[model samples]
Target: METDKRNLGGRPGITVQDVQRACEALRKQGRTIGPTNIRLELGRGSYSTIIRALRNLGLSASSKHKGGE
Candidate 1:
């Protein structure tokens, strides 16, 4: 119920860390989180944003894991 206009969890624009946090949250709920899901959560247009985050996280992101999204 706490919402701030600025830094909506970090910054005005979405960041890789934001997507990663969302993914980790989904995983905690026992749901499979992927780039697509992260994009949706971040209100992004494509998976590229998520891919960038994956790369920054040192993830392979070779379409073999994370539900192949």
Candidate 2:
């Protein structure tokens, strides 16, 4: 029951730590941790790619990934 139109996982070639670091940098700049910001921060990757990575990392627009800070 699988289809090429549906992907079961996040797109490859991007790292969680890289997203995390980008999120951290965004936080420092008082920006939101959304796909567009992340993509701009990354200077590569599509929005979907960034979003999947964020979802995989349990991060969202209002994520507190850097908790206890």
| Pairs that collide, model 2 | none
lDDT of each residue in 1-61, candidate 1, tens digit only: 2221122323246666676676677666656566766666667634665666666666644
- 10 residues in a row with least lDDT, candidate 2: 1-10
| Tens digits of lDDT, candidate 2, 1-69 | 422223434555556666777988988987767888887898876666667667766766455435446
**For model 2, what is the error of residue 59's alpha carbon versus the real structure, in angstroms, after optimal superposition?**
1.5
Output candidate 2 Cα RMSD.
6.6
Instruction: Give the whole-model CA lDDT for all candidates, comma-separated.
Output: 0.57, 0.67
Error of 1 at 58 (Å): 2.1
- Record all residue pairs in model 1 with backbone atoms less than 3 Å apart, i.e. clashing: none
Assess every candidate by TM-score.
0.55, 0.65
